[model samples]
Target: MSARDLVHPLVLLRRFASDMGAAIRVGGVRGGLLATCLLAVGSLTPAYLPQSSPYWVPARALGLDSWWAKALGTGMVIAAVGLLMIAWFNVRPTIYVGVKHWAVLLWWSLPLLLAPPIFSHDAYSYAAQGWLVHNGLNPYEASPSFLPGPFADQVAWVWRYTSAPYGPLALQISHGLVELAGLNPYYSAVLHRIPALVGVALVVHFLPRIAILMNVDPRGVAWFSTINPLLVIDFVGGAHNDALMVGLVVAALYTAYRGRMFWALVLIGVGTAIKQPAILAAYPIAVIGSGWAGWHVRHLARFVVRLAYAFAVSIGVFCAISVATGLGFGWLNAVTVPGMIVTMAPFSLIGFGVQNLVNLITGDPNGQLIWKIAQTLGLVLSAAFVVWYAITRSRTRPVSFLAWAYLAFASFGPALHPWYLTWGGLLLPLSKPSPRVWRIAAALVSVLLVYDAGNMAWRNDLVGLALAAVAAAVIVLYRRYLRGHRPLAGLGYHDEEGEANA
Candidate 1:
């Protein structure tokens, strides 16, 4: 967008280390040391990914099936989490916005970007979608199985015949990468990941800025989300496009905070093109932009009109991208495709227990029917909650309503995935979540890291165990620190009225 923006991210990132707060400077050093440990863990993960990447070791050296390799992986994962715990919460509240945290994030995340896809082969699937676009096929209607090549082979088997669930804008990015590779699918899968690095840079840059504006310590807040192990491994290591979506959404939030409502809407629309989770951001932003904090018939009408205008502009952007790429709106149904998954979210878990209970009593099994009914009910309730919150009056900081509402959706909605957690997890920092929120988020991270159910389920569990260990360490250290010091007074506070609402 500007010559300054075109400056290399590395040079820019290094500059961020300057002018560190006293607390931040001290904690940042610890964060840097911990980041080195994570770097080693991420470097080793490529060998264990579903499909080997360019940096993968030979079978003899990195056999995922071998007991010793499994043990080594368990140890590495535990060590990674433990070190992260010590850096993030064990010490005093440190401001972590400087060079130390940025370097740590870069050191840990950079290598994985060039390594093989980790956690999921969604990158390969994205490449296949791009291949469809390159070959003049509609990605929404066409499946990766339509193309037979090394790229298609890299996609997971179950998804080979499935149309892309991601937005068409995402298709354009992937397609452009493959096109740049001269239509070579193999290179496309790897090249498509380059954009995610840019996304990381955006997160690295904007999150600190957002924290500062919110009157919080940018150092720890930024470190907690930006250098987080889950974000690092999934985004950089797995090359998931979720990174792109989050970067756009976060920047959009920053824009809205700065009072550029129109640009915020535009960013939200563009981010939706990356993933559907971002689409949810539109509601809260629209509500805030409407400026109807009071109840009146005219106020209600004004709110609706403003909301429609925002959607018109955002949807107009989406339509333009679809038309330009010739990738029609088949993605409309893609978001609903998750209805088939019996997710492990709290609402779904309750339904699952109820379904199992009914089956035992009736001596007949109707798990599917009951589960679907419960899932639908849960989704309805979650959506209602979101709408209620979106329209509610916030004294200041519109992110308050949006952050809490979106988090409720993620926690209770039917669709669940570890990466999906980042949708609200990243924004939590912007909203100034309470200590309880941080504890909940920490626990969820540990669980999500190991929640895979089939195929590599056991291997996932070991990694999960490591994260659980790390979670335990965090609780212990947090309590230990609580003994010596009073509760943290945030970096700064707002006016009494602002604080009440914030």
Candidate 2:
């Protein structure tokens, strides 16, 4: 036997175990195995059992009765805290890698892969629009309240009272399904989940491709992109349409990187059909068409031409869908009305300041002017960032484009939802690590928002205290880490080559 073969098997096993322990100390759990599972269960509990359901007895017994939904919300906070701990302690690198690791990851994420549709009554809006189309009424021109059923009035207050601002194409499609399904909200909700799952699946599939295109390690991409806790909880569990938009955006980038410009434009067009925010990706396409290394007037012209083509195709598709489904175009304009903006974690800056200002200036505690100002700032800053990035950065991906787009929308758009931040979270791994503290702070704040959204009573003081504490912690941790203190030594920096370009 060779000298190596002569070594004892137990000795090798012991060495392997030691190395794994060290890796976990550094990288946390690479797949976020345990955290993802906890978050999945925690976030979906409210969906399966309504707040008034008897299943909440256990939660009430545990002091979560103020809002039975808070039981799940509290659990999510604990899971997020666990994730942060894992991240803070740097436990991923030491985690075992191989089929066993992947199995655990899959096991955790699978329960969430298709958990019964829960949270956000937005899906009901989609169902209502579909029902409208089924009844041969233009969904764009009519609000859910105009319909004649319990489902119509059951839409979330924001959607029921507000004019429809969503692109008509998605509504038209949903309406057609409503016609086919005969006014079943549950069925419509399930159908909407199909696209949502498709979006998540697309991300999982294209992530490896994205890593390859960026010349980064596929393993890093797999661990960081597909299996992150934020991605699992926000996209998979929350069932937000932004997840699909993100998937399409990423696919477009992957196609463009492969020189499939035509396909990329088509995908971007489809994404815009789903949500108007996706139109921002056209900028990155223009950048790519102009070539990565040089600036040419001819290239700029070509970029504009490509952009025009994308816009035309997107508009055409949307119009066709509208006409086919009898959903008029009026809904496109309805999405812009000012309304109660929920406090999403990143956008909470506006919520905190605006709510207080309104209370102070008008002596009306429910005033929303401060939110308006915060949104204005968010728009101004986001626009500035996009302009600066276009001028300074050589490589632009769809994720980058979508990230900035969603940031602008969250900041300036009429309403905010904590799950909306999922858009940015999905793309976070693609950006530079310099913003790690801000991102982590955003995630923590999101946990608080989830809690606030679940429990109405906590709106006043509990949420505010939580937000302040999180913000303060982020500031302290950032200051220490910036000084080379290794505040998160167990989470050793795993810098992929050329990541700076992304």
Q: Number of the top candidate by lDDT?
A: 1
Cα displacement (angstroms), candidate 2, residue 325, comes to 3.8
lDDT of 1 by residue, 254-341 (tens): 6765778799888988887787677667656675545565668887787778778878877777777777767778887666665555
Residues 110-224 of candidate 2 have per-residue lDDT tens digits of 6555443444556667777777667666666677778756557546666775556666667766766665556666556546765666787787778667656665445544555
On TM-score, the leading prediction is 1
When summed lDDT is taken over every stretch of 10 residues in candidate 2, the lowest stretch is: 486-495
lDDT at position 49, candidate 2: 36
Task: Summing lDDT over every window of 10 consecutive residues in candidate 1, give the lowest-scoring window.
Answer: 493-502
How many clashes (backbone N, Cα, C below 3 Å) per candidate? Answer: 6, 18
What Cα-based lDDT does every candidate model obtain?
A: 0.65, 0.56
